[model samples]
Target chain A: MAPAVLIEKLQKRYGKVEAVKDVSFQVEPGEIFGLLGPNGAGKTTTIRCICTLATPDAGKIEVSSINAIANPKAARQKLGYVAQEVALDKVLTGRELLQLQAALYHIPGKFAKERIDKMISSLGLQEYADQKTGTYSGGIRKRLDLAAGLLHKPDVLVLDEPTVGLDIESRVVMWDILRQLRDAGTTVLLTSHYLEEVDALASSVAIIDKGVVIAAGTPSELKDRVGGDRITLRIREFCPLEEAEKAKDMLKSFPFVQEAIINVAQGNSLNLVVTPQSDALITIQQALQAAGLPTFGIAQSRPSLDDVYLAATGRTLMDAELAAAGSRDPKAERKQNMK
Target chain B: MSSTVTPSKPNVSLKPEAMQVSPAPGFFGELVQETLALTRRLFIQLQRRPSTLIAGVIQPLIWLVLFGALFQNAPKGLFGDTVNYGQFLAAGVIVFTAFSGALNAGLPVMFDREFGFLNRLLVAPLASRYSIVFASAIFIITLSAIQTSAIIAASAFLGAGWPDPLGLGLISLILLLLVLGVTALSLGLAFALPGHIELIAVIFVTNLPLLFASTALAPLSFMPRWLQMIATLNPLSYAIEPIRYLYLNSDWALNSVVMQAPWGAVTLGGALLVLLVLDVVAFFIIQPLLRRTFA
Candidate 1:
């Protein structure tokens, strides 16, 4: 069977700004694929192209073998999209909104009724079905929007930031629902800025930045490829820079240690990259103790997705997020979204 | 937060074969389904929040009673050979109400675009996106009818007398043509303008100027040469004059002169033809805009 969604060299530009530049990825059937990036990283733009909301300047998009760019209507039939912002008509009750969604997909009346009820119950929206969406909380509104997107039963369900504003409980519930969707053989493609969201749910992920894909793989494979277990140790909670540097220099000479750096932002904590071994942390502790450096705290864990991003971009995801937030022009972005 | 509320096999029933469970309903059937669905959404909104409709009806009735009374004491033949100023002003108010209401048809669409709800419709595999255009036209025309009926009833009560049944039917046709043409232009603006703020700005500057330029409040003969020329050229004047002719004349026909413009006499048939031309031209002007957005 063909890949559920294939986008090649996808390029989309709004005015002088290239929102998506050379993005390419493939999502196989029955797996949760994630496009992980910070804001303004072209994640939403790529999803728009797949959903037929915007035309890409240069690209080929295929949805289950249909050329999405050339034949969007057929592709649209096979794909379901839940937008980043839940665009519900607040005046409409949840049930009425679902009926409108059902009609748009040209679902048969009887089948649509059955499908809508199933979606409502599955999303746990039975009690809120008859109330106006304006009266719903953010969590309930999102669930209703999800039901609307799934009512047509598309082959691929594409969501952009599915849990951006939800509370922790709602976010976890959303994750559970998505896992169930994939288990039922629906190809799921989502974009999210939350590291944990993708790490916990996506079987495969592509990390994008500045409109380009820099890394793509399963989460564990990416962690393994980065080649180290991380050890964070602080000689003192607010260790002097010279003492932290001394600790880092001593830790670097160990046979199992791959790299060591002093993290000044974390009060001069020493971060070490080491080859996987049970005694690596003990060796570092022993070296610190022999050098008369006091140990305030110490912890060891496997490399995380953030480490992969840091390795590829040399900047942490949090740093990239803050930078993106400062530079984005609200007026220009709203104009692009309107069209 | 409990997992029990979450179904383990939520989409299990959503086998791909469910789509094949129903045969294709054919193109026209799909078109009607989507159009009616869209149109139904608008009606549901109107039903739940009736303020706009209530204001629409009341505003026109106020114009009929208050504006007519303001000019009540004018000499009987000063405006025309009509029995009263109310009679002469009745046609203007009817046409103006429809024109203003139709001019605002794009506001909802513009709001939808701004709020991102339009993306929901665009993402759907619609049979034809023109169904969006169709739904707006149908809703606006129906609204114009309701407003027109309310004004006509108020005018009759204020002693302006009713048009014949055939005259009522013709009045509906005239409003339909005017509403459709204005609605097309408004929707074009909704798509072309950047946001609802700009669209509303355009509507604000357009509404009163067009009313003044047309023969809505005054007759062509009463205006000076330049103003008369502008009023005769105004499409709203064509809509107003024919309905005024139907109201004041008991034995009217297609050939009966409705207005004596500065150029020449414009008969009832000629006026209707102008509205038809305006409709065709409006559609042509917005065709490219629609294609750009829809594509």
Candidate 2:
């Protein structure tokens, strides 16, 4: 059987902005696939093309072996999309909104009622189901949007930033529910900028930057490809630049320490990538003490998804997010998203 | 954590290949189902928040009463023999109310577009996206009917005599034709325009101008020659003249002269035909636009 979802060489442009340029990925059945990237990295644009909400200027998109461009209705039947913005009508009760979703998907009347009831119960929305959605909390609204997307039990469920604004408790609940859906044989695809969210939930991830897929693999695999243990050492609460440089120079003499750089933004703390070894942390602490630079705090761990992103893009995801934020035009972005 | 638990139906896999494929339903059945589903949503919105409906009905009633009182003592027999200005204004108000209501039909659709709710609908497995347009037309036409009734009742209360049974039938026909045509145009604008702001701007500029240019407030003869020609050409006049003629004469025939245009005299039957043609033309005119977006 073909993969549940396949996108090859996907290209989309909004005027001069090449929102998605040459994106490609395949989602295996019953796996949680993640599109991980910073804001303005074309994650949402890629999701839009897959869900048939926006036509791609080029490339092929297929859902369950059906060409999205040629047979969009068929692809729509197989795919369910939950957008980043919860587009619920303020006047509609949660139940009414689900009913509308059921009808739009052409669910049989008998099955629709049962499915909507199951969704309301599963999402723990029974209490709020009768109230207008305008009165719902953010968490409850996202849950309702999720229930609406799942009402049809689509073959591939596509979500764009599903837990962007949820509280920790709700975010946990959403992750559990997504895992449950995957176990039940639904191919789940989601896009998010939260590295930990993807690290915890996604079985396989694609890290995209500026509309290109920089790295794609299982979280552990990608992290292992970076091939180092990260060590963060702060010489002082707010170390002087000279003190940070002294620590960096002292730490670099160790054969296990592959690279060390002072992160000026974090009070000149040293961020080190050391060759994996059992006692790398203790040796680094001893080296700092010998240099007469006190270690305020130090921690060591295997490379994380964030490290993989940093290794690939030469900047942390947070830094990329800040950079993208300053350059983004809210009006132009809203216009791009409007249609 | 009982990962070893086996299903009773071991062969019943959840994969797509295990699913049975059934033949899709016939075209008309699917169309009707989808259209009804969409129309039901609009009705539910109208029911839950009856403000728009209430305001729609009340506004036209106020126009009929206040406007009728404005010209209550106009020169007798000036409008026509035995036809008071109030009586003459009733048909115009009814047509104008429906026309205006139909003109604003695109607002909800435009809002849907702006809020990304339309994207939700577009991504669904709809049988035909035209059902979206059809649902809007049904809702707007129903709304115009309610507003038209309010105008009819208000006119009757203001001593504007009621149309005979046959006249009422003719009036309903004309209103439906005009509503269908205008609703199509409004929905077309909803899809053709970029956003709600642009759509509202167009409606704002077009509404009062179309009302003034038509025979809604005054007779064609009262206007300058150029304005009279424009009024005759306005589709609103085609709807208004027939109903106005019906109210004035109980024994009116289909071919009775209703409007004296600059070009020639248009009979009641000819006015009805124009509305019918307008409906057909408007539907075809928006076909390509709807297809480009919906297809």
Candidate 3:
């Protein structure tokens, strides 16, 4: 079967700014595909092009095998998009907003009514359905928006930063709804900057940075390719930089430890990359003790998505986010996002 | 309670087969449905928070009562053959109210673009994105009708005799044409302006000046040569003078002379033709702007 969504060498530029340089990803039917990146990594721009909200400067987008650029209305029918900003008419009640959304997708009246009720209930928006959305809390607004997005049941649901401002409980709930949608055979493609959000929800992820897909694979596959077990050992809650460096130098002497560095940002904790071995943590602890250092906290685990990002790009995702944040102009970005 | 609860099985009701649920009703039917739905949202907003509508109606009513009172002591037949100043000001107030309200038609669209709500409408599979423009026009026209009715009733209550039933229908038609043209231009501005602040600034400066330039306040004869020329050229003058003629003359016809400009005479039918032309030009000018932002 053709992929539910196929974007090939997608290139979108806003004037001189290349928002999406060369993004290519395919989301298979019945799977959750994630586009993980920093804030300005072109994830939203790529989603916008796929959703027919903006035209790409170059490349192809197909929704359920239909050429999206050539047949936008047909492609729009096949894809449901929940934008990062929950754009609800605050004056309209939650139910009213959903009903309006249902009509927009051209759902049959009887079917729309039934499906709208199901969506409202499924998203736990029943009690708040009749109240104006302006009175709703942030989580309630997001839930109502989600219900509206899914009211017409499209083949693929594209979400841009779906959980950006939701509380922890609401975020977890959103993840479950996405999982359910996949189980029911709806291809889900989401763009998120939160590492854990992508890790927890996406079956496969493409990590993008500065408008390019730098890494792509299952979370474990990408982490395993990085090829090292991570050990985070803090000699003390606020270990001195000299003591952390001394411990790092001592840990580097072990045969199994491949690399060690003192992370100055985290109270000067020592991070060690080691060849996979059950006894590696003990050896590091012994080495630290021999150096007259105390192990305030320590953990040994396989590399995470952050490590995969670090392996692909020398900077961590958080650092890339900070860098992107500093360079972004709010006025220019708002203008870009308006259309 | 949590959306993330892993269900025992998938929602069988939402199976992939269900995803192929249906296409819209026929194309035109779908277009009308979406456009009407969007239009309904605007009406709902007006109903719930009626300050704009209330103010729109009251502002014109005040102009009719107060402005008429201000000119009460002027010499007889100084303005026209009308028995009082209220009759002449009635048409001006009606045309001016519709024009001002229509001029603001773009404010909501500009707000939608800024707030990202327009992105919601753009992403939907509407038959044509022009439905967005259509919804705004429909809403603004309906509002013009309401405001026109109130102004007509107030004029008659204030002793400005009612026009014939046929005259009222003509007034309605005239307001529709004027609203259609002005709404198009305003919606275009909504797309062309960078933000709401700039859009509002434009509306603020253009609103009262356009009213004053047209025949809404005084007859063209009361103005200097240049002012009469400007009033004759104003589209609002076409709408105002025709309705004014209908009020002053019960024996009205399409060929009845409505406005006598310094250059020549404009018949009722000719004034309407001008409004129609204005409508066509407004649509033509905004086509590229709407396509740029909406397409």
Model 2 per-residue lDDT tens digits across residues A1-339: 788988899999999999999899889988999999999999999998888888999999999999998889999999989999988888889999899888888777777787788788877777789999989877778878888988877899999999988777667777877887787788999999999999999999999999999999999999999998999888899999988887788778889889999998999999999988899888878777776778899999889999999999999999999999999988887777765
State the lDDT of candidate 2 residue by residue for B254-282, as single tens digits.
Answer: 88999889999999989989999999999
Off by over 4 Å in 3: B1-13, B17-24
TM-score of chain B of 3: 0.93
Give interface RMSD, every candidate, in order.
3.0, 7.6, 3.9
Error of 1 at A74 (Å): 0.3
Local accuracy of candidate 3 as per-residue lDDT tens digits, A1-339: 999988899899988999989888888888999999999999989998999988999999999999999999899988889999988889999999988898888887878888888887777776789999998876678778777777778889899999999888777767877888888778899999998989898998999988889888899899999998999998899998888777877778788888887888899988888999999878777877877788899999899899989989998899999999899988998898887
**If you assessed candidate 1 against the hidden native complex, which CAPRI class would it receive?**
medium
TM-score for the A-chain in each candidate structure: 0.96, 0.98, 0.98
The CAPRI class of candidate 2 is acceptable
Docking band of candidate 3 = medium
In order of appearance, the predictions have TM-scores of 0.96, 0.95, 0.97
Clashing pairs in 2: none
Residue lDDT tens for model 3, B30-125: 889899899999999999998888899999999999999998999888887677788889999999889889999999999899999999888888
Q: Give the per-residue lDDT digits (tens) of candidate 1, residues A3-83.
A: 999989999999999999989999999899999988989999999999999999998999999999989999999989999
